[model samples]
Target: MLRQLGSGAQYLATDINQHAAETTQATLEAHGVHADVIVTDIMSGLDKRLAGMVDVAVVNPPYVPTHVEEVGCRGIAASWAVGLNGRQVIDRILPAVREMLSERGWLYMVALEDNDPSDICHLMSEMGNLREMFQIDAADYMMSICGDDSLKELSSPGKSGSIFYLSQDERFVIKTLRKTELKILLKLLPKYYNHVRAYDNTLITNFFWRPQDYSERRKKGSLCCDEKYVLH
Candidate 1:
């Protein structure tokens, strides 16, 4: 399905069972699609060559809960013999996919309700911090947000005197913080950062930037702030 959707993009498929790899290749051939199919255990031995280069990754890992001994078994059983909570294969694939992705990469994964998709998302979020792993410059992202001409103001129903602006891509929300709110956040910043770093399933909103005194540098169509701006 991904092959048909992204026909112009390169594809690489891997499986632990040689038969499964062969079947995948045959299916691609039948559909007149080209992809490199390899017999390997979840991208093993391909890291050095492909790390941090993949633009998109699709995963449908083995997710059936079964006895520990059933995992890695030969033939058809290897397809869905994930042990215990069905996270054995899924957990391994998460970090591997994170390593394989480019800075702007996206991942599409299949998960059962029993597999706990929320926890999986949280785990991937911790593993795929672009600023830490990819060394993306903070200033570059700030420039993109500040220079965006399509930012739209959202009406606030609350009586906190706060103004809200949504980014052009809708990936970020810029909120003008009051002096008291800024002080509280500044005081909590250290503890908050540490808490989020330690907890994989933390539900806190990710605050990207807290720029101070942006009134002088505001552009014509850019966001304006009297004191502080918080981007999340």
Candidate 2:
């Protein structure tokens, strides 16, 4: 994504581990991409400068339910360890993400059923009135596509350990699915396309895949799930 952002765009990345930060820099170098990588715990030191300047924010936070002590280990556990109800880090970052997002910014996050995805969206909406201006209109648009007032109901079980959720704007989605889920989606793609064509008002747009292996991609601690798919 940083590669596609162009040289003029400022791409910034953060991680708690210094090694992870350096590894990210090396990967970017190998890909001919450039970004300002920092070792900080979820925007800790840069929030003030980045406030309201981020046009796009993507977060694949730690969502696995575990003990509090397992939340912030320095080793590989940093990649997936989360606290009670799987919300330790997620709860902390929500406010920061809300404060940093530009007026038109969009956030794409990966969530689990235990995270209470609906409440997460609602919390974000309530934070500093993020959705106060667009609540009524956004609700109407959301209903046109989802046929309901709540976007949460659109969620369906995708795999053994994951689910999927689309935002009110239909711009991006929070998903975690498996290769089996991808296969089912591929089989239904034709009908889905036809339905979108028939309505001509939805946002089920774009489909593409990277050449890299999905498991190898996740080893980098990316949010891209097993056999990842992005429904724009």
Top model number, TM-score: 1
Please report, in order, the local distance difference test score of every candidate based on alpha carbons.
Answer: 0.69, 0.61
Model 1 error, position 103 (Å): 1.7
Candidate 2 on 41-124: residue-level lDDT in tens?
787646447766788888888798888788658688877788778876776677678766877998888989998898778756
Angstrom error of the Cα, residue 59, model 1: value is 0.9
**How many clashes would you count in candidate 1?**
0
Summed backbone clashes in each candidate are 0, 0
Model 2's alpha-carbon lDDT is 0.61
Using lDDT, give the best candidate's number.
1
Error of 2 at 149 (Å): 45
Model 1, runs deviating above 4 Å: 1-8, 130-193, 196-232
For all predictions, the C-alpha RMSD in Å is: 17.6, 15.7
